[model samples]
Target: MQDLKGKVILISGASSGIGRATAELLASKGAKIIVNFRSNEESATEVVYHIKEMGGEAIAIKADVTIKEEVNAMVEHAINSLGKIDVLVNNAAGGIRQSTFIDASEDLWEETYKLNITSVLLCSQAVLKHMIPKGKGKIINISSTAARIGGAGESIHYAATKGALNTMTIGMSRELIEHGIIVNGVAPGVVETPFHEKFAPNDDRLTRMSASIPIKRIAKPIEIAECIAFLASESSNYILGEIINVSGGR
Candidate 1:
C-alpha cells in the first residue's frame, strides 16, 4: 500500500510556493488533503482542481492561521469533510522586507510574528485534540534558512519569527511525543518562490544568492515538498523533532 494512502493531511498557505507544491505531492500519494489559504482563493482553487484532475482527493479551505477562530474553523472544516487529520503542515509565512532591525517598524515585527509563529501555534493547537484522540499524528513546520543565517538589510523580524518557530517545534515535539505525535520542520534556503520577488525584487541579489549556494542553484518548490513528504510519511517515523534543511547545501 502507498505510505499515505489512508491518511488525511491539512496544509496551510496552500495557494502557492512550497505549501501548494507539498499539497499536490501528498495528494498524488493518495492522502486526502485540506488545502488551506488565507487569500488567493483562485490559486487555491486551481490547486484543488489539479489534484482532482490527477484523481486525488482534496478540498480548498479558507483560513488565516494567524487568527485563533479562523484556525479552529479550518481544522473543524477539514475534520468535517475528511473525518480526521493525521498530518498538519504549518506552511503559512510572510515575506521578508529589506530592513534592518533598527529601521524596522514595530508593526512589521508584530505582523511577522503573527503570521509566522502565531499561526503555527494556533493551527497546531487546533489539531492536537483530533490527533491525540487517534494516538498518532505528524506536524511539519516549513521554516527558513534565514532563521539560521540572518539576512542583512532585511527584516530581522521575519528571521526572528522563524527562529521562534524552530524553538516551538523542538518544545512542542517534546511535549507531544508522549501522545504518539511527531513534530518536525523543514528549513528551506533560497527558493524561486514569489516570496523573494515580494521582498528583495532585485534580480542581481537573486543571482548572487543563487550563486552562493553550494549547489550553485536555488531550490524548486517540489524539491522542498519531497522533503516535507518524507517527514510527514511513515518513512520518517523515527525522525522526530528534527529540522531537515532543503537549502541546496547552503
Candidate 2:
C-alpha cells in the first residue's frame, strides 16, 4: 500500500501485541521485517515463520531494549543482516501493573521508566546512528492515550513515561528531520491485546472500559498497526513530530 517493497523495517517487542501486528502488516506490504523480542524467541520465530509462509521476508532478534549495549548490538545485527533499516517501530513496552499515586511502589516507577522511556531512548539513539548517515528513515513511537489523561488513575507511572515519549517524539522530529529522519508517535486508547491480558485480566477491564469509549468497544492490534504503517510510509513525508491519537474518542 505504501510501496514498502524491499523496505527493511525493525520492530522492537515484536513477539506479540502491536509490535507483532506492525511487523506482519508491513511485511505483507512487501517490507522485510526484523522482529526484536527480549526473551520470547519462540513467539518471535513464529512471527518470522508466518511472514515467510505468506511470501514475505522476516527475521527475529533478541534484545533487552532498555540496555544500551544490547540495543546497539541488536541494531548492528539487523543492519548486517538486512543491509539497511528503512523504518523503526519503538513498540517495546509493558510489564506495568496498575496502582494509585499514594500506593505506587518505587520499583513500579523505576521499572515503568525503563520500559517506556529508557528503551525508546536506547533504541532510537542506536538506530539514529545508522539512519542519520543514510539521510533517510522513519521512526514510529508507540505511545498511549494515557499520557493525556494520566491513565485515569490506573497507571500514573506508565502515563508519565508516555508523556515523556510524546515530548521526545516532538524533540526528535525537530532535531532529526533535517537529517531526513521523520519521528512521530501513535497513541492508542484501549486495545484488545496481551497487554490487557497481563495487566487487566483479573477485573475484565476491557468490558468496563468499553462503556466509556466512544466506539463502545476495544480496538484490535491491527487497527493501531494500520496507523503505524501510514507513518512508516513516504506518504507521510510531510507530516512530522505529531502524535496521532488512535483511541476510540476516549
Candidate 3:
C-alpha cells in the first residue's frame, strides 16, 4: 500500500467500472477522492458512501469531461473541496458500437475522439496548472489493447482514440517530468465492466472474447484498478511515459 495519507485524487467517470474501483482502492490507502461522474449520480454516490463506510474520505462531482468548461469547473471544484489534487485518473471513455473502419460514420469518429482523446487532454491540462505548481503529481490514463491491435472490425474509432491517448501519455510525460509530474497509462483487455455489457451485449460474445485470451478469462475491474493505484502511488515515481498492459497476455 502507498502512503497516500492526505493526498487528494480525482477520478473521472468514477460512477462504476475501473474508475469506481480505483477510487475505492485509493481511498482505502488513505487518499481523499473526488469522484467525477457525467450522468450516473446515484452510482457515484454509492461509491462515495462505500468509501466513507470504510472510514475513507470521498466526494462525488458531476462533470462532462468532453467539454472544456466543464472540465475546468471540475478541477476547480476538486481543488477547492480537497485543497489539492495529487493524482488524476483519466478513465472516462466509451464506444458507440463496433463497426468496420470504412463503415464507421463521421459522427461516430467525432464522438469517439471527443470522449476518449479530447477529454483526456482537457482534464490533463486543467489539472496540470495545479500540479505544476506543486512540483509533483501523477496522471494515469486508462488505455486499451485495441489501441495496439487495431479494432478494425470492432470499434476501430475507439481504438484509434486510445492510440492517441497512448501518444499523448508519452508526449506529456516528457513535457511534464521536468516539473515532477509523472504521466503513464494502463491498457486493459476484456475486462468485466459496464463497458462490455453495453458494447458486447451478448453473453456468448463475451465468453468467446475471454476464451481468446491466454488467461482464458476476462479480468475483474479490481485487477485493472490495482494497476492504476500503483501508477498513482509514489512507488511509480521512477516510471514515466509508459503504458503497462494488463491484457492477460493477449
Once model 3 is optimally superposed onto the true structure by TM-score, how far is the C-alpha of residue 132 displaced, in angstroms? 0.6
Model number with the top lDDT = 3
Instruction: Name model 3 segments beyond 4 Å from true.
Output: none
Sorted on TM-score, best first, the list reads 3, 1, 2
Question: What are the per-model C-alpha RMSD values against the true structure?
Answer: 1.2, 1.2, 1.0
lDDT of 2 by residue, 11-79 (tens): 999999998899999999889999999889999999999999999999999999999999999999999
After superposition, candidate 2 runs with Cα above 4 Å error:
202-204
Give the worst 10-residue stretch by lDDT in candidate 1.
Answer: 149-158
Q: What lDDT would each prediction earn against the true structure?
A: 0.89, 0.91, 0.92
Q: Quote each prediction's TM-score.
A: 0.97, 0.97, 0.97
Higher-ranked by lDDT: 2 or 3:
3
Model 3 poorest 10 in a row by lDDT: 149-158
Instruction: Give lDDT tens digits, candidate 1, residues 1-250.
Output: 2378888999999889998999999998989889998879999999999999999999999998888998899899899998999999999998535667778888888888888988988999999989998899999999998899875446678888888889999998999999999999999998878997777578888888888899998999999999988988888999889888999899
Q: Number of clashing residue pairs in every model?
A: 0, 0, 0
